[model samples]
Target chain A: MSRLRNRTKFMNKFFKSAIVGLVIIAVLIFLHFIGWLGPVEGLAVRIFSPLQQGTRAVSGQGKSFYDSWLKKKDLLAENSQLREQLKSNQIDVSRIKALQEENELLKKELGFASESQLKHVAAKIISGVADPYSQTVVINRGQHEGLLKGMAVVTENGVLVGKLTEVGDGFSKVLLLTDNKSKVAATVQNSDRTAGLVEGQFGLSFSMTNIARNQQIKEGDTIVTSGLEGQIPKNLLIARVESVKEVESEIFKTAILKPIVSFADLSYVLVIIP
Target chain B: MWYKYILWSIVIILAAAGQVFLSSSQNAIMANFDLLLIILVLLVNLSSFERVIWFLVLSGVIMDIYSSLPFGIFMVSYLLTAIILEALFKNFFTNRSFYSLLIIGSIGVLVYNLFFLSFSGLIYYLGGSEYFTNWRYLGAIGWQLVNVVIFLALAFLFINYLSKRFKPVFLHS
Candidate 1:
């Protein structure tokens, strides 16, 4: 009788503990779902990011060796050909000086964006997303680096990728432009005209939505952010049109675009924080 | 005895380090081992139900700390798996049957995958329609299948080797 009673007591305690454990789990899942648990996500990224960095360093060693040993011979020949071209072009010094002045002026105009008050933070890509299914990348800048959630992330070439989703002490997560959930407001560069939302599709491609079929859209048209959200600065190059589709029944045409930046080859990025 | 625990701990840490560092840059063919799962399976086979339960909790905590997912999801899944396996061993079969062990381990892997998918689905539903799409679901299925197959092979080899090499220590205990 005593042993049976003890078994029942143990079973009861187990059941209660299991129930409590499940409840706690459900609540944590709920918090994560709603984006309230950003700190936990950041912590996870920080803990695992070192492993990713170490892996990349080890793999890159072999590539560096090959570059120095095998690629150097070809590079030297190409270097001399380029040097000869430079020597020939030395006669056009006056014309080159004029072009450099014009180039600097254009850069000054481009840099003088309306959101000049927004602070910019530079970051380096430490690792790609740990899980293949998730389109995220870890940057070396984080909360300690003054990065925050909703900060716009871009390449050094000024192409918008995504925003900071989670920020740790020394690292931040950038939801890549290829992620299905990512959307950015953009405009066509040719006319400075047609504006629509740029939605990322699978395989690193994106499609511009809400574009009218009759809008002066065409192949090779450049896309830039409209800065409607105020999260991202305006006129940043996003992509170029690869193809366009128009349907009579539909109100808007869809244009498939190739991203301006190759996300997979990203080594450095800039985070624009307002 | 204390030294043994220390050795196992070192092995577990090294395995995690390898998984994180070495496996990330390697080809998919070579990145097949889940060292944590291998260690957890070994511990389950070598220890009693109560001790296994504690180890499951510990492993789940470590995984949760390292993973981007929610904290307690792995804990619940690991504990549930441990309990089910323990119950199966106590009620139905002897541990000596290699075939039975394999079947059980495969089933456990399937269950873990199922739990992972369901939890991910739940997160999708709760978060928004944009959280998960058709292509993402397909990708998840592919990755899970690969994980399951790799884990099955690793578990089988480890069990076979351990049973042969440490028969007196593991089987007798």
Candidate 2:
């Protein structure tokens, strides 16, 4: 019985506290609605506004940073794609340039062949300096194309380049005029039509020897094949006389010659079909 | 084994073709570079004797088909070079190291040139070709040595990198 009474006493105390708490909450609500708590609310808002704004600013910056990252990723992909396109365009440009060069060479060759009324076969150089010991080039046309041994090979401008030394079925090897083994009967364009044997010296340059001391030869005089050799035709440009050497004790005068066409740049040539 | 031989034969043919292409005068240094010789030198150090011999013979035959040199000239040169390389690998360069490769490759180039030039001279004396030896020919030998050393070094580094990256590790029991 005493325990029941103590429990009731405890419940009464709890009810008293709850009633007081309810009354206080109701009074605060009334004060808030009647503007009685305005200064305290203003003070609380002023204290929390900076933190709220900081959170909002952080979220905005994160969103902007994420947007910029996405943009950068897209730009990188676009840049790589553009780089690939540029590489392909560069290859196309080089191909077009090569085709243009080949076309120009063919046109010039056609012009020369048609003007001279010479029997010829157009051939492209397949390889250059095939022989380590000799300055030789392999041509695409060979015995199959009626290119025989000792056939004269010339450039598009009718400049004598070499002769077919080794002729295979589908390919022919041309011994370039710069080769030491190369020899040609040439005549100067001067009045005397000075006869000399043009020989390659060390695969570097040409020297026209066996010239009579009385023959007048000077620098800048054009040297052409004299048609003395049955394989080579007459009046094909070989070289220009660079300098002439005369010695009274020597039996023959020699003239140093310079080839106008570079052997390295001989991409296409014409085989004079004898 | 058969497939390996076939692969090597194909490589030899390709090397021959590459030689023909590099022989062009468009680039002088590349023209002087002997890709086949470099491959042979490398192969001698790595492969078995029988396979190396087969490669050497194939290389010589294919090169002879394209070369203006007398028949059997390239074969002799390549064969002798293989023999020398084999001896050197067996004796001095037993271990497969970069320095060993460099030394062997350098000596191989020199030996090949010596044999080649000597044979060329013999053939010229016998009235086979019009080739005349000059100091400039020696320069070609030097360039070929440089090319061989560079190629061997690059190949060594690449193979080493690949081996290290993909090596299978055996765990201790």
Candidate 3:
């Protein structure tokens, strides 16, 4: 009988506590919806930013060390490949520089805006994929760095990464191009310059879809931003075509893209201030 | 005691920090590790319902601050998970043994994923956002299940073999 009474008392306390918890959560949701939680969130972000940044720095170092130790053989092969690619790229750079000057002169003559210059802000990635449903990375720079929503983020080598979705005082969240919600107007850098919409597939890979069957897109084609979206600039490298899927009945064809940069191992990303 | 509350608060904060650390590593394998969820599930089995509730709310709040999803998703998922865990502990898997802990932890992971996925789907359905339902997500849950079980088993071994500080204490209703 005493045990039964103790059980009843415990049950009462449990119900009361759960009810209180539900109310607190509901109130928080309401405050967030009404935009009253921004200041509080900003304060929290400020407090946590330093800690997250420090942690990320340490973790990145540790991960790289461990990865190198584990994949020494693979690293050796990759290093040689990169060295060869670097030599070829150096040649291409010189060629592109001349073309860039000629293009600028043409733009001046035609009264078109030159796309050669862009503002770049370096930021460290503090966190990646805060939740399962989204593919985002939080960077250390935010409003303090003049970052705003829809600003393009990229890798150091000028590969398109993502765009800022949420900008706080101290940190900003970049919605990666691999997120299902992310879609970029992309063009195949082939002779035909075929255009399509590059969409993220389950945060794992990317696909260039909505390509008209008549357009001549093939494997090994480079995909780059089309600058159709005002925020993201043109000619930023996105991915490469891995395979093209064609169907007789479907009006459009899709191509699987292989991302040049691994989204999971990103340590630093540059935010374009354009 | 007041001191206990403060200590647990610190623990919850550290758990949140651990989540940030794990997410920052950028390793695909580490990405599926849910530190906060595992902590909540473990706390539910080891502590009182009220204490678990306290930790749940704190964890939810901290996670929500980092998440881009609408507020209350973490809170709701964590709350419902706590309730389910508490109920499972009290009514179903009542043994204070390794087997019971494994069962409870597995169920907790599954329940939390179910709630989180469903809420996310609902949000997307209502035009709040977009999320892809893919086979990889199911595979991620499978990995989490394996991870939690391995973690609990190792923890159980460490407690039973190495230390008595965190021995399993059965909760009483």
Q: Which lDDT tens digits does candidate 3 get at residues B49-155?
A: 77887787787877887886766788899999998888778777877689998888888889999999898778867855322224576578889999999999787
TM-score for chain B of all predictions: 0.58, 0.69, 0.70
lDDT of 1 by residue, A191-251 (tens): 5489888887863677999997677789999988887876677877788999898888999
DockQ of all predictions against the true structure, Cα-based? 0.11, 0.08, 0.25
Candidate number with the higher TM-score (1 or 3): 3
lDDT score of residue A190 within candidate 3: 86
Expressed as tens digits, the lDDT of each residue in A37-87 for candidate 3 is 767777777777778878777777888798879999998999999999988
- TM-scores across all candidates? 0.64, 0.61, 0.74
Off by over 4 Å in 1: A1-50, A59-118, A190-192, A210-216, A247-251, B1-26, B30-33, B48-96, B128-173
Cα misplacement distance, residue A154 of candidate 3 (Å): 1.9
Docking class of 2: incorrect
Stretches off by above 4 angstroms in model 2 are A1-111, A247-249, B129-173
DockQ of 2: 0.08
- Arrange candidates by lDDT, descending: 3, 2, 1
Worst 10 residues of 2 chain B by lDDT: B164-173
Interface RMSD of each: 5.1, 44.4, 3.5
Clashing pairs in 2: none
